[model samples]
Target chain A: MTDQASDLQEAGGQPESQDNETAATEPGVPEAAEKSGVSGKEVVLARDVSKVYGSGHAATTALRDASVHLHEGEFMALLGPSGSGKTTLLSILGALLTPTSGEVTVSGTDITELTSKEQSRFRANRIGFVFQNFNLVPFLTATENMLIAAQFASVPKRQAQDRADRLLEELGLSELRNQIPSQLSGGERQRVAIGRALMNDPDAILVDEPTANLDTKLGTAVVELLAREIKGRGKAGIMVTHDVRMVEFTDRTVEILDGVVCC
Target chain B: MGLAWKEMLRRRGRFLSVGIALLLINLLVLFLVSQLTGLDEGQTGAIRALDSDLLTFDAGVDQSLFRSSIPVSDVQEAEAVEGVAAVGPVGILFGTGRTEAEVVPDELFDMSVFGYEPGSPGEPAGLVEGRLPRAGETGVGTIDETVKSDGVEIGDTVYFAESDRPIEIVGFVDDSTFQLQPTLWVELGTWQELLAVVRPERVGSEPTANVLAVDVDPGADPSEVAREVDSSLPGTETVTVDDAIAALPGLSEQRQTFFTIIGMTYLAAAIVVTLFFALITLEKAEQIGILKAIGARTRSLAGSVLVQGLLLAIPAFLGAAAVTVLIGATLPPELPFAIDTGAWLTVGIVTVSVAVIGALLSFRRISRIDPANAIGGTGD
Candidate 1:
């Protein structure tokens, strides 16, 4: 636990915004429940999530009784040491991994009750992912990479193409739309990754170390761009990062120790 | 499918390598099939062209034309049998034809001499330029069109290498090759004279034939009549024309050998394609994980892989087909190589099917990929 705290301290700087503590402790309630004019609403909720890998002697608990919430138009930073189960929790929320015992609701649907195939559909239609390495398919051009997500959503080719063009242009990657991942720089590739994630108009974006591969300047710019996109689109976003400078762009930070979230 | 196509286009070098490999394999298969067809035709074309319904040989000779000896008495007995429409004594002997105009080696112009009575069903039909040998004619014969390629034509004199007896070419017939050799239709007496000189001891006191071509009555079953003829004649066996062709020396064995080679080629091609797809699937593991992570269905990912395979296979098949047609068209007529369209169509379908089956080997890998790994920076 001490090592976990030190790891968090090393990754995150001082809280810079007045809303950080409130956002961290009390996630925004859904607009329908609030009965107020606030447009933001809770997009994701995970209750008492626990994940145990393997069985018997080989059993390893990756997440233990962790609960979290993400709201629309808010950026949450997940900070933890290596192997602190921050990724495990994100995977569960994204419906990429099934929890041993938990209820995860995204948008308005309880995803934990869905079948594997339905979960896959939920992930494709409602969740977007940004990986640390900018895992863009190396063989596809930037536009194609973005269109692939739309394709999975069964969007018509013409519509998908239009959406892809709009996203690329929005990401300031219009000039490099024809370039493959290998032809793009680190920042450009990460932007393409973001565009791909947003192509499906997912309810929430799950980002895992989006700036780990970029230099300080590029990394900061990339995070700022992500923050602007989330706020501009009013989509809920959770970014997992080990770099401290990236915390400035997020609305709140939740640190994980061992496998539980820390206040 | 668009993603699949774009991937292929982006990695043209890898796909092209597989495509070229497939092309070479298809070409080899097509060539072998064409060669088999041509060789089959050359070996049995004359026998197939015969008008007889059944061919009878001496009993106890296992359907072998070379070993069969039908005595003149057996021929009479077969003709006397019920449902026997007509009987023609046809003798086959291998010999060489030589022209005085050139001193060419006899081996280069070896001919299969088919002896038949005038107006008999065993005689070659479709004379392009000349007529059949006259009855009882001892010094004249008709040669197939192939003889013209060897500088022999109508009215030209050719002598048997053994007897040196001059035979005037009285006619030219089209497509009369036998046992992969040029054929010459001679009067039965002329063939007997040459045979007596070549195998004096084998030609006993009575004249003998290698086979008796029997035409069955139109309404009668040839197999039944063949059985009756075989029973009525004390020392004879009967077979249909097809059976006789299959019984030709070394023909069945050659067909089996060619088929075995073709089967192995198909198996090898399938294995090669499987290996190629497997390697490509391995290389794309991370990309597949990412796609799955982004909500790409397993079906679509697997479909993409299959589409990639087809993109390579279809063009390769077309290229091989074109190349085969080109080669078949340009090859010299003397070579025993014929391209049967039916055989080629079968090969084409099988090639594509095998390619698809090969691509299926990667489906399991694609389906098992964990999408979770894609986000953790650990999939690759």
Candidate 2:
């Protein structure tokens, strides 16, 4: 834990994104050529994806013939009411559920027909996630919790450590690296979750209400960080959130009601 | 996956509880398997020590020679069978033996002496430490394994029943126990002399032997050879190796009891493992959704839990092994416990299998995790 990391700002006393000003630009990098493997052209594309739970009469449709396209280097929000099937759509995008009928491609490859191992690889390699509860593993140090996720992705130990360290510093959490999730406040833990999602330099970030637990002031700070850091890294970020206030930093907004995309 | 492992570790109490339960269960299974293996080894050793293709006794004789004897002439009759290559007389007698020169109790041990030909049929299979005796001297042999445990050795001398002269210490053999009491070995002539004072009339009228040990032609049907020998001597029993070893009285019951106990203990362990992991899964329902939302595959989640199960099982198995070794080492000399290699392998495999099956409870949780729950799993 160090002084610079304990605070959220960089050592140079500049906005975190300003540190990348000198970074060499990558041209001719096809979205494919981009270092992050997240689908650069359309990170997520759902064509008429639908989900229905239960059976006839009792069956409830969670997602309709819904369609949406997401691309790299964008910050978008999936906004809707509690029962509007927004979360269901997120699950479908995450590949946790097989929509009753639809074609879904993530990172340019279809997910519907991928084998179990491939699905696992897709999750491990291309995707990063931030849950609303800031699901920091309670038993391990913040570092250990982040490393554990890295392990599933089969990231080499040394690399995982290096990535975790760099990300922790960028997020201004270096001093808290050894603290357990239980010891950190809601905002700090959420920031830790964001760091974990970004540790592998994933192609896309799927944040499920990244600031649902924080106060209005902290919630705004969290979303601003996501927009500046996530977009700066040239990765797509599709966040599903109920908080309209957090939607201010987004470049685009898509709303869902009765399982249909409205705007 | 590494992430799942972190999740498991971050939740220390849950992790330890499940791991400890798995460890204890696996250890129990391995220990029990070892005991059963020991029993199997002991039984096989007994059968092997006989080194005979067939046995013969009077029709009225009981399961083993401790309870019956056959005519010495039965030995000759069996040798006459066409397929019988050689025959030797084995005499079983209940007697009191003394380790040294004392009369009342000084090193005296009760034993059943089985007499055998020095170089041929029914010779013991292996030795613990010493060589079998040559003809010029009578080699009094005892079960070598027992001798080691009891601190009895090749040079120890004992006085046999009905004989004042002490038989010279000669050799040590293993797997000669009947009803768990080790038998000693001596020359037939020497035995006959010892038995003379106990049964004076039979010593002269019959000079009968207890069991007839037969080595048949390798190519001959053993059953036919046994029948041929039985026909030559009416009212006498001719049994093959299968009958003598497999039909040993109460042996089947002993085996059945051994397996039943071991199986029940393993079943109980599996159930305990399942319960422990099930509780962990239930408590971590929200965390599971978090993983699912992150695009973690269901099988990877299941496999990670299984890895935890295996880890816990190994230490438990080690603990059980330690307990088994401790009990075995402290057991008195008379017990016929015979654990061996086959037992240890069986234990490890059974323990691991039990642990994995126990963690299957988590597979159900993995399948049901809806990534949507990651958004607001608590519904708050």
Candidate 3:
């Protein structure tokens, strides 16, 4: 067993042996492949990524030599405490922030080297994000929020509408399609956010603290649905969370501490 | 675009305040435009409507029609000049007139007594009611239609307060006004008699008129004819009707002042719209961050902001125009309130352009919004 896995088991207070129920597979290996004793394609790869925020004496390091990856259908939990640089690494992988030094390959593109506009387009087409606070546009309806993702990728309106309708139905939010964020409950709003993320049928998903505003029961239900989506759709996903309970929903857990990553 | 419109519709209450402010600004601008038009018409309508192509004033009087005193013989000399077709003397006397019956006591109507040849260059062009005064007629005058609002009618005798003289309203003329007062067109004899009674000192050794109206021959240049007339009559300044109107005392200054105020108003509107959107952009910084994170382009976001500003400004301008028209219809006619559609259209175009510019001014803040804020440090 890897020392990181042993450390995770100890920190999680689990048994010495990881069973099928607590499947802790390789960082970039599909869960189904592990179960079937086969291998799958690696979908997300980050190599020696580091992020520095400033310059000279005022410079501060947010991430250091972080390396992680996710395979097709793999759901990974990025477990970390406050200021552990997990979000920073996620941001870099999402093409939202440029790392001081790193190679981030999502799907097939080296996003770190792409221009700002190209990165934005790449994010819209290949990567989906679910913000912690469910940042749906307050004035837009649930369906519109979902359609906005497609709009960013310049999808045809008819096609986008069709996808939005399917997403809303799949997320169990069909009846509340026309309801804005204010009218939606906490869980419903999160579901809308998820619908938005999946609208583009992206290659990967990045979820940030999906249950920070929900109760324990609702939080678990949300995480379970997220894992099911990633697995059933054969897409890679990374969920950044500090909750140890939430880690069980993921196929693997990558711990981050003091700007360092242990996968 | 749809998102911006949806936000505006859903949060209409929040936008209504700024909408109202823009509406009030439009109203003020339109009203000022109308007032400016009315004032121009009231001050220069009589001169503008004259049948002559030019008017000759005493050079020493600085283009003041009432202050100018030209000898009657100057008309003959102006008519004798090359390219001159006809010339006539025009006298003016400012006074208040009331009906003999005194139906509305103390509510005197302001009137300017204009004396000219009945069928000559200075005659009122539009005689809407009754017939013109005869060449030698006295104690008979054609009054402006505006006096009808104050109960004056044909055959009614109007008593001039300054001279205590009575003149019969033989006809009514349309759009004849001078210095915001309705005009009474009468024969030269009648005007001279009133002028003599009001200011005997003005009755010099020879008959005189306030100014000489000169008609240019067909195919002749009015300016050239004016220069000839000015040279012939040594102490006189001859100008085309347009130049004469432009030289009206304080007219250009008044228009300049009004335009300056209107310009400042447009500036204020731009600033208000810009500041309002800036604050709103700040308030929605989180939403902007999320949009950026979702791959929304900065140009698209800026376009949405511009669309929102237009959505507010357009309706506001339309509402203001409608209200301005309604108010124009209800205002007292004597107050000189007139609506000019061309002016309103100009204002509308300027207003929309200003609103668009204001919307663009807030784009820097929008472009600066960091998409990383969507995740924030808490997620780490």
Candidate 4:
């Protein structure tokens, strides 16, 4: 926990922007949450992260000195419209995209310092991802899809099988374990995707537009399910979405416009 | 590899289309190889089956058995060389043979008449049934098994129109064609008599042979002995059995032509594989992007594509091989369709390897897919 506080102190000096001070003083966010760098025993932290695409005058600054964090047992929503840089921020934190400048730490390991291969390994073992389209491998069954997450982390087959079975049962997908993604409904597929994200018991789960393809009723149901699961498992999560209505399901919401972050 | 298998099983129709295309290509290539082998064997089987270590031909004849003329004295000289065991004179002449009664009046078949010493290295080996011609037997001969298609049997008489002579077929030998014609093996005296009758230009000339087949001592190297034979007998050239087969007329050119065609066919198969996998990769770009985003390595993804290619190629090869074997069994004896195991294995290995290489062409496209694309797309 002290290491996380030190990481926050290091982040405090990077590009002293007003958004950073505002994020630090947001209401209902305890002083401990600020000092611990977002929540108790932070699972993911980003300090002044900036992502610039291209080179020279053609460079497009996708994210500008964005500082963010996720703590265990906390579920936060990154609210933004199109081209608002929330997805870029998510991509950087997930290790799918590299920050042009700044640092990111996940599971207490500094990701920005690792090589591309090491980042891949770290992503496989420490973080999980859920996509808007519910990117389940169309050919694999629900159980197999969940097990693939464990496979990416090199988990033993038998252990992965047991974990996948338990996750499917928890998600109420046990009856549809052998069915492929095409056979599953929109909400069902998202549930399978959620199950896969949790299969490795990762430190942080990053989801992108999870309810974009679902109806309002099903979308709310899925978000509630995600909130319950994140709270029950005591894991950190960040869901990126444009729908403001979905914000009520999360413990906190961080809004973004252009390339700037606002609390 | 597991993921590849699952996807292939799920998309049977998609894979089957390419699989059937591969099957047809394999069949065409394999059948062409079989026919080429059959033609090559038809031309060189007699020389390839020789029990002799070396053969000597006239120096200026370019190893042609028809044009080369070796005097009887050359056989003696080769026999006298160091490390020499025995030397036999071989004579070849083309003629037409008509089987005895129970056949049509003029059902003549092309035949190559070979003259060699009975019980010598030049004699036909592997008699399918019956015995070789008895020493000093003037009018008895052994015929190639292909002659049976002309209804000529052992104990039956074959009349040669060119030589104005008739001989008894006392034995049959298999795989003994020469110049794509059935061969008839007879004693040297009988061959000389027939030669004298057909070509009367040499009524009182000395005996001659088209080539001299030599057997070397047990401890002698055939190549060394061949060199010695050439040095000892000036105006004569000696070569091992393999060299003799390679020197056969039109054989090397025919082989090269067929190999070129086969190589082009393999290139076309590789192109088909490359095109199919590239299209499939394009279709699954979103899925691949998602996989990479979640942590799939480039190596594993590329390996999966190769695995899928092999999955299609191996079964296609097996199916083609089965059909080739069936075709070989049903083909007529004179058609010369032989099933060569070495060629079959080589083709199978090359086919699978080419398919894998072709699938690897898609790796570039897959590696360039940005995980960022998977973020907001509807995945439709």
Candidate 2 lDDT score at position B363: 90
Docking class of 3: medium
How would you encode candidate 3's per-residue C-alpha lDDT over A101-197 as one tens digit per residue?
9899997788889988998898899889999999999988999999889999999999999888876766667788999899987777877888788
In candidate 1, which residue ranges exceed 4 Å CA deviation? A1-38, B72-85, B101-108, B125-131, B134-139, B201-207, B217-221
Candidate 4 per-residue lDDT over residues B163-184, each given as its tens digit: 6567998999988888898888
Better of 1 and 2 by DockQ: 1
Evaluated against the true structure, the overall lDDT of model 4 is 0.82
Could you give candidate 1's per-residue lDDT for residues A100-172 as a string of tens digits? 9988898789988888788778888988899888888888889988888888888899989987777776566
Candidate 4 regions exceeding 4 Å error are: A1-39, B101-105, B202-204, B378-380
**By DockQ, is 2 or 3 better?**
3
Q: lDDT per residue, candidate 3, B1-380, as tens digits?
A: 88888888888888998999999999999999999999988998789767789999999888999899998977787888999998989998887777864435577878888999877899888889898899998888998899999889999898765565679889998878989999988899989888888878999989999999889999999999889988888999999998999999989998999899999999999988988998899999988888889899999999999999999889999999999999999998988777878989999999999889889988999999889778853544
| Pairs in steric clash, model 4 | none
Q: Give the range of the ten consecutive residues with the poorest summed lDDT in model 3 chain A.
A: A6-15
Whichever of 2 and 4 has more TM-score, that candidate is 4
Off by over 4 Å in 2: A1-56, A59-74, A93-127, A139-163, A178-180, A199-204, A252-255, A260-263, B1-50, B98-108, B123-175, B199-204, B217-228, B330-332, B360-365
DockQ of each two-chain model? 0.46, 0.39, 0.57, 0.38
Q: Which candidate is the best by lDDT?
A: 3
* DockQ of model 1 vs. true complex: 0.46
Q: Evaluate residue A261 in candidate 2 and report its C-alpha lDDT on the 0 to 100 scale.
A: 87
- For candidate 1, the per-residue lDDT at A130 reads 90
Worst 10 residues of 3 chain B by lDDT: B98-107
lDDT (Cα, tens digit) per residue for candidate 2, span B154-178: 6777677646767665667776655
**Model 2 chain B poorest 10 in a row by lDDT:** B135-144
